[model samples]
Target: MIKNLLFDFGDVFINLDKKAPEQALAKMGIRTIDEEMTTWHNTYEKGLITSDQLIENYLKKFPQLTALSFQQAWNSIILDFPQERLDWIIELAKSKKYRLLLLSNTNDLHIEQVIKNMGAVRYSQFQNCFERFYLSQQINLRKPDLEIYDFVLRKDDLLANETLFIDDTILNTAAASSMGIHTWHLEPGFEDVTQLFEVKKALF
Candidate 1:
């Protein structure tokens, strides 16, 4: 039986534009994100660069875009966070059926936009649902890395066999699965996270 539920916040609960970077760059008149820019992005996620620095750096690299234009492009990655998901998770948490946790590979810039788009009250409600919520930026670690899984497991004294991690990314799922934790890769056409627990029982 699954005693704990670990969820990825992006597509599992909220929707995101998968081509956001491409689209954002197009809007900013940048043709593409080059190899060096990719490293800068990773550095930003790892807390090596501040959001302001990232904004300036990106804009400077292009030099053809306005700061506001880049800012808009940056925030375009953020998408709708539906209330239905929140309500569902809230009810699920209240049942005490499992220890709920949130583990997401997200950075400060995206979070800032989520806060702005979701508002403080709604965002707080979402954060409060978790027994523990871990963000990659704050932890200085991202997914597809084994240490993060170990971080949560050790922190909560979780048994891998009894922990279920649901994420939209295949790499993230693979990492957790390698550690013996049950995982579900959320796919829009084939699976729905809202019905996960029930589906697991049905599989039995």
Candidate 2:
């Protein structure tokens, strides 16, 4: 039986414009993110680098864009959380049937933007629903990485087969599944997290 539930924050709980960063950068005349940029971004998500380092790196490559402008472009991917999803999770927490955990690959700039978008009151309510909240930037670990999944499992003393991991990204879910965790790879737009009971009836 699934006694523990691990959820991805982006798309699964809150809405995210996956392509917003590229679009935001494009508007600034940078059409593409090269391999080096991709490495930098991943490093930032892993908390291996600081925000100032990222800004300095970007400034070196694109002298035209200021630190503030780059930060705005970087944080463009975050969007609002729907109230219905919040209600569902809050209800689920009230039941106290399963251990709830939130895991996300997020950075400082984006997290700040999330607080601003979600409002302090609502964000606190959403956070209180979870037993543990792990953000990549804060944890120094990221999804799609077996080590990170192992850390969560070990830290929580959770059995892999008894845990269900839900994420919008196929890569993340696949990694979790390989570790013997049950998973739901939620499809954006077509599938909503609020319909968890209806969608994964067998699990319940």
* Best candidate, TM-score: 2
* Residue pairs with backbone overlap in model 2: none
Query: For all the candidates, what are their Cα RMSDs to the real structure?
Result: 1.6, 0.8
Model 1: per-residue lDDT, tens digit, 122-148? 899989989999988888878888999
Worst ten-residue run, lDDT, model 2? 195-204
C-alpha TM-scores of all predictions: 0.93, 0.98
Once model 2 is optimally superposed onto the true structure by TM-score, how far is the C-alpha of residue 165 displaced, in angstroms? 0.4
lDDT of 2 by residue, 90-193 (tens): 99999999999999999888888999999989999999999999999888888899999999999999999999999999999999999999999999999999
Model 1, which residues run further than 4 Å from truth? 202-204
Clashing pairs in 1: none
Q: Provide the overall lDDT of each model, using Cα atoms, as 2-decimal numbers.
A: 0.85, 0.94
